[model samples]
Target: MAYPYDSLLPQVTRPRTISPLPPSAPGEEAKDEEVEQVKWKRPAVVTPQAVHSKRALLEKEQEQTASSEMPRPSQGELFPAREQEEQHRQQVEEPEENGQNIKAEPQAELPEAQSDIMALKRKNKDDMRRVQEENLNQQRGDQQNQVSERVAATPLMKHPLPSCLLTNKDHVQAELQDSEASNKVREKRLEEEIKIIRDKANRLSQSLQKQVAIKKINLQGLQRKQLTVNEIMIMKRNRSPSVVNYLDSYLLGEELWLVLEYMDGGALSDVISETFLSEEQMAAISRECLRGLDFLHSNHIIHRDVKSDNILLRTDGSVKLADFGLSTQLTPEQNRRCTLAGTPWWMAPEVVTGQPYGPKVDIWSFGIVGIEMVEREPPYCNQSPASAQRLIATVGTPKLRHPKLLSALLRDFLSCCLQKDEEERWSAMELLQHPFVTSAKPASILSQLINSVKKRKKN
Candidate 1:
């Protein structure tokens, strides 16, 4: 406690040091004199960039070695001076400030000028290879997309229920059972709707003094499948109320499907055959047909076949001119069709005589149909179809079976329609203004005829 102040002051302490063990193996090694002498080798100090460059150089050397047997790169192929001596001379003759270069030494060189060309060749080869790989990947992607689209487009069989009622039934019975079970609710709903429609029609007739045609609706699902391209085109013609409506078109399986308006009144020929129509009724029918023909002619279409068979009627008193299978379209400048394409009996004298006819030919056919309305048959229905054609070609004009039954004005209209000179034939628009066509209201007249025919058919 009584030590000097200097000794008691805080002092800095040094760290304790431990020495390593000394080596003594040299002495034993010296005793073994037969051991080979070893030299002290220094390790190379390599950076990350140097290692990468070394790898690239090795790859280049491997490529050059391979190129001796395989195809060389485009750049290397152009320069053939790849000899070792030339390389050495190029290395020794450095670019000195002189007119000519002399070799300073005999050693191969890594010329910086050639370095750019080598780098460019290597880069181009790599880019070309990468581009080819990308193209291959794109092609693979395209093929996969096409396959997926095809699979998505194809329809597979889908059973409705999880459990099956395999109660020892045949194939037909099984199908019937399955169909009934699936559509039972839908069928009941449709039956109720149909009942409502009939009741509404009856109620409207009683209360509002309006009659509606209540035909049974055919409720099969329409599919756009199995229709030919030509049928589709015909169905999708330019629409007028006189023309049938095309609702939709689609593709199913290997076919095209078309949905069209249901024309239930049957063919015009059936109506004519089933009932004897009055003159006013005949005039009304001719009026509506002329209207349709006028519309078609105005649009530059030739209804080559114009007969009762091609006309259609709706339950609610609408007339539509149907069946354009043989119809031809004329250009804005053209006015004639040279082909003879009408039905043998309905063909015009001009058409039968193998003359170039225009929309006027349709006028002749309409005249025959007018005659059909009065006679209950075409002009030469008793004759063979061949004979009918020959008669049409040679005969002056078809005579109505009962000319006394037709009024003088009506007879004159038919005469205008059946004119031998197409220049003299009454055009559809002009025929629409005829005194015969003006005698009746089309909707009421035709509707009466249709209702009577329906009653006759039912009886």
Candidate 2:
């Protein structure tokens, strides 16, 4: 089959150099018409140098291949893009000059393929730049994340205090804690102290209550020991009117305590008025009464209420004065009697006259008591207390009846007992030696009375 022109094989035309028209005879015109005709082909001329360069490169490749164990290069590998650019430029310039026919598709194909290489290089560079940028950004992000993590994990740091300020602050805190602890300890100790005080107060209150109870019991016991008035009056009714004896007494306590010796014999006025007393009875009662008074006076005690009701008779008929409730001791001046006290009938003239009386008044009252005993009634018994006081003021002294019936010794004793003057009164000891009470009978009588009282209670 015949190939179409479009698909025909390419034919290259080359120009050969004719021997330079022999330079015949210097002026012979260069053959204008007959000289050797030279044929020029654009492709041949244009490609020849390239072909030689390719041949040299191929030789180098061959040499490299022969010497090395490496494989031979491909046609494209042997001629680098730059060398290919120079070859294309040579080919293009020749074609343009010679108006040669060229395969447009191959030339265009070459430029396009080269542009692809440039594009690939640019793309690769862009990819590399992008990758590097991504790496940088990734690093930045990682750095930012790390910074965020650190910021989140760690607390912000504060500025440091000065060393002195720090030390002072620590010291102050320690002192404050110490003070609080000390206060707590003090509070605890105070609680203990309060508890102790409360316990003491309770115990003291209990002790005081116990003491009051004991005192109350003791006082009740003491009050219950005495006899009742009704029982005493009954006993007095049974006894003889003139008898005064300890046998009529009552025992008052569990241990036979507080014996009340009887203080009766009717009244002294009754005893005297019934009869003029025998000398023996007069001497006995009078001397004993005086002795009792002297004993009281020596003790510095004043019997302010000495009277017939207070004069007691023993069972054997001896006399003893009693009831010293209103008595006073002159030893203490404040104890001096200020109140008027005594039987009006037997009151001393000084007492009746409203004079301040001391123990000496006892002597004057004793004389009056003596006068009543001898006569058996007070000298002013018929008069009222006021009239008797007036009588004492008007009369100098009292007189006793039956003065002649009385023995001289008894008379003198009675006179001595009735002496109106206090200084003239005999002391109880002086009267003890007087002929009246010197007999052993009164002493015997006292002993017998105490024994009788003791025996009566036992029986």
Candidate 3:
């Protein structure tokens, strides 16, 4: 309903506003008073920084009041004083242009100097402490490594399998069993191969002719050589014996298996038993025995059982060595064996000591044979084998003391031959050239005896 648009503007109406309720209750009045007091007490115009500072100062003050002791400030506090007092203090404390404080530059530099010194001391101490700790750690590591190495080196008893390994035992066993079966197959194949080789060897041996050429030997003239007790007795009966010589030869394989030689005479031992072997006799026998030993040794053969029983004498009183069954060929520079394989009575000290001995052992036995030839019995004759062994181990070297004997030469030679140490024993060749055996008269006598024995056989 527009009436007079130009005459009147649109009527404007005032909006109603709601008003807050007035405080009237006594409790509410008290709360409003508290809130008003808090607002009045708070600072009116505070910045964020000043407010934060004020809060911190209040908290500090509260903490100081609550604590039993309060810490003092690092810097001293300045105080407001009367004008005359301030003037006097300033004059006394401040440095004058020509005062000692101004002149004492070195003293003023002391604090800085002390701080630098303390810093260096602290650095050095820290370095030393660090080095010490590193060394201690290194030592500890070394100890641990040593302990672990020892543990690894020590053999351990059998142990139960680990739990995880035990769980897979069936699989492991299957693998091992397969390997064992393969080894069995390989062994069977090797055995078959060996059998084939053995069969081939047997077949080849059978197919091939093994012919042994037998030389025609004169059997009709071969005398049935026999050694008889009567012959031996007759040979002993004659002190000035007939000369008998033996052709040096070896024969093998007979029914009785006898080593036959034309008997010239019995051993010099038998003669020595009945009659005393004079110095000439002893020297002659010694030279002959040494010659035999030298010849045997030069052939690398050791007549290990060198004794009166083994040394046969011709009727001409010349000796011939026999019985090479106990002999062995010694290699050059190789020590003899420890087979405990010689006549117990003739064994060297080294043999009794249960050690490997060389051909020097024969020399030691030869010394015993020499004693037997001179005395007609073993040195420790009456004792049992055990007792003899004990005596030998202790002191049983043959000692001779004949007035007519070559004391210096014979005694020293026998001593060397009977040495307990194998290294010290004389070689057979060395014994052959010794003065007692090699003297011109003794050598000539031995040569005459040997030639007579040979001539008698020839006749």
The candidate scoring highest on TM-score is: 1
- Work out the TM-score per prediction: 0.49, 0.38, 0.41
lDDT assessment of candidate 1? 0.69
| lDDT string, candidate 2, 25-67, tens digits | 5445523321221111112244555457766997897787778
Best by lDDT: 1
What tens digits encode model 1's per-residue C-alpha lDDT throughout 1-459?
Answer: 132232433342312232544555977654332111111111122234535665589679878888777755644356656544343332232342354433334224344534555555566556666667887999999999999999998778555433344443456698998899878976787667556655655665566453433222222334212224433465576678877655554333233334456576767898988888777777777888888899889888888899999888866677888766577778767778788787888988888888888898899999988888778888888898889989988885887777887789889989999987889899999999998888767565576667677777878
RMSD of 2: 44.3
Assess each prediction's global lDDT (C-alpha) against the native: 0.69, 0.56, 0.57
In TM-score terms, candidate 2 sits at: 0.38
lDDT of 3 by residue, 34-64 (tens): 4443222221222345446655896797687
Steric clash pairs (candidate 1): 224-257, 225-257, 226-255
